[model samples]
Target: MPLLHKIAGVVVVCAVVLGLTLPAHRRGAEKESPAGRVGNSSSAAPAAKVSGSPAPSGSPTASATPLKPIPAAAPGAAAVKANELGQIPVLMYHRIVPKPEMSLDRSTKELYDELTRLAKGGYVPITAAEFVSGWINVPAGKHPVVLTFDDSTPGHFALDAAGRPKADTAVAIIQRVAAENPGFRPVATFYLNKELFGMADAQAAAGLRWLVQNGFELGNHTVTHPDLSGMSEDGVHKEIGGMEDRIVQLAGRHTTTFAYPFGAVPRKGKWARKDGSRYSFQGIFLAGWRPSVSPFADEFDRWNIDRVRSEGKIKENDCTKYCSTAWLEYLDKNPDERYTSDGDPNTVTFPKTAEDRLAKEYRRRARTY
Candidate 1:
């Protein structure tokens, strides 16, 4: 070979060797949006996927994997007759007291018994955030239920001497029931007020952090639990935004969901969903009598989600038909009407007959068997 050709060949070989041996350049991290600040929409809307790790103080920390179409065999859908478009019971509780003193109060034993029944019936607990995000990741043949506690009462959460959950509290009872029943998730969403579970500032902070660390979600229930329907837009914003700031200060996690104080949306309904970006609730719940439609259902409204009261079949309390007891029994009798998981989070599976009931946006994730 000529000297020039030999030099060219050696240069080519050196370039190839360098390309093979050099380490790949690291890609810069993508800038993420502030967590839990999903768009405010009346209808069910697509929320940005949140990062899993906790953000800094006064910021939000949550995670949700956006669903995508995966055209795979859904064996569990047909065998379980899974109905992704069916009703989901987002049961609401106010006070888990030692004794039932009022219509809204549930005794400790009653709460435990109800949870036990839910566990036995193959119901898995998911947070309000997950429900509103349409992230129902339950196992096959399991039903997703949202166990939400409002008011952040002392009975809702507290710590014992050794930092364990105190006995007779809702947290302790839920943990106990979950331990007894295999696969029963102890997770729940506690909508907090300014009171912070009636604990001192330090204790409250510890309790709030513990709940979040242990898979529980903290939500906004306004600074003062007021009848929002009668409040002005400014008043509503103050209450909601004030609560959001307080939650971030105390829990260090932004709230992803909100529950109306008295199930009352403002005269202008949009105020319930947002307040100038101080807080943006992906899901806003009402104190409802019946179970709500699936998040992916055509009629589902993220801003006006329904939540059933925690009561038995008592005519005096006017819960004979629509309360949790009657509703749970009704679902048991009519299993096909309840939301059953297809065991795949990425795909939303339902019967062919219910195909039309699904939201059009979710068609990509829809799997009809």
Candidate 2:
């Protein structure tokens, strides 16, 4: 059997044992609630210690060095307050496809059922901004869920093998759920990269416009989706600025949020160029750089906000299987942990093994509790 299958089997066995051993009330608490309750204050301390490098304080032009003993706050508190009553989780998704071969991606039916389940569970969907701004404060007993789609693939908007928007089934389910329950208005964020527009057969350009018109927010995922750390100042500007330009032209809106491709900085610093170099020119123009590893400072970078990537199979019946409410709860209780990359921002290091990837996942999930 494959590693994921083995891991899945282990999870199943563990879940069964956990279910049987846990107290009845606790078991009920663990019974895959509609959504994990987000606490108003994060119990976990800041992940990284801000260095005392005497860097310019609070200036966009400050050096990009990690600070030590950084002021620790509740997890995600700087970006958005923890849901005091309980919060709606912002789930991240990359692609949705029908073919079984694309296990990494989800099918339309699966996506539809997932939304239907959220609706049935009384989970309200909110936008990423709403989650960050701490607005739309949901009271206790009210469940909220945020849906995000990354990579802006054409398959998301078009039919598969047939002639339909690939995400039509899922979108329909979301729209239906939203319409049926006024309080359950579901919102999704699309992190688009301009390069992906013409790669596929479908007219993705037009589809993006359609998504925005229909009430979805278009977010920036950088122009070419390259690691920004190693790139010179100029390179960063082009990567970010270029995409912002395209998003405005296509979606008729300027994007404030960005998703880091591969989710880490480079190590070798090949992408880094001198401040005056042509490549450096782009970086100089960019509003700022957001490093995912530095959750403390990164959250303050409104233009380059950090996000936790949701991985594994996302089924309507088992949305929490990969990232359960229990796990998120655990993260909420322990906030010092943050996601990190192989090297500094310029030169990046990719995960070398399944263990490495799992470790990364474990760390990312640790914050949600």
Candidate 3:
């Protein structure tokens, strides 16, 4: 009787082990993991030596997907309103260079420090897509930031010899910062003009794919980087629509944001328009001298969104006119007006005195502390 019981137990155990192991192996084969596909993104793009990079390429895939909207608990609460209300600063940068002759041109070290400062200050980088869709749902007490690079310079992106992104570019710095900081995310928006990464066609295409696959974002800065104030209606359409087409061709997705060139748009409502030929963008970013209001603020408008230029006071130049320093200083002077996270992302919290000024959408889920 004992021998028969032992034999039956062994057979049962063997069947259980096979059931557990076979499904895991099958699951592994079902989908292409991020680790395997990310490495080969630069293989199609030939290496080019550029001043900005080892330096240049092209956009969004990452393991930690962006916070999608939660279903609304109240009637009339749109999905976007499900996002907690908080202040978000979208920083605009250009030329992540090794050496900086101009104040606008930031060195890699400076970029690293800025990212570090944000991470240490309880800030998380959100993509431009997240900003536009109003899906920013970062953990409680963490502020959302958007690091946007205009001009698609070589220093913004570059690939190493082994078909991997170089670690010193802005993209690499963002990713590296996220790796070191537990809750920080590596994401930024790159606004493209021609010759992104100094690669013409094929390499540029590859670079764009890499950016998209790695969870970074791409936006339209126009094909020729023209000032829209001087252009006619048809010209404005061409400047934006054309770039959108090329970016889609490379990334296999629609680019939903547009940044104005030289901080200028042709008309008030004219910043965003789609002819029969193209997809209309949801966000239009302005060149800002200050941080923007909350995406859900009563004053906030998607088409006329603002982005603070990334520049600290370098040498003798005061960059506050076009940089974010001005707004930071203002907040320092009047801290009460500044939006601060109260460490609970599930429910929106702000000052009781500030309640009357909040957007209608925010008031629903809001709790004033």
Best by TM-score: 1
lDDT of 1 by residue, 53-103 (tens): 333444442332355443643776778887888899999999999998988
User: Scored by CA lDDT, what does every candidate get?
Assistant: 0.86, 0.47, 0.69
Clashes of each: 0, 45, 17
Pairing residues by index, what is the TM-score of model 1? Answer: 0.81
Candidate 3's TM-score reads 0.71
| Candidate 2, residue 290: how far the Cα is off, in Å | 19
User: By the lDDT metric, which is better: model 2 or model 3?
Assistant: 3
The whole-model C-alpha lDDT of candidate 3 against the native structure comes to 0.69
Provide TM-scores for the models: 0.81, 0.49, 0.71
Candidate 2 lDDT over residue span 215-331, tens digit each: 666676677778676776567667767777776666566664455566544342323322232222111111111112221221232223334334333564354443433334433
Q: What C-alpha lDDT, on a 0 to 100 scale, does residue 148 get in candidate 1?
A: 95
- Give the residue spans of candidate 2 off by over 4 A: 1-88, 137-140, 158-170, 179-182, 195-206, 265-369
List candidate 1 stretches off by more than 4 Å: 1-73
Worst 10 residues of 3 by lDDT: 46-55
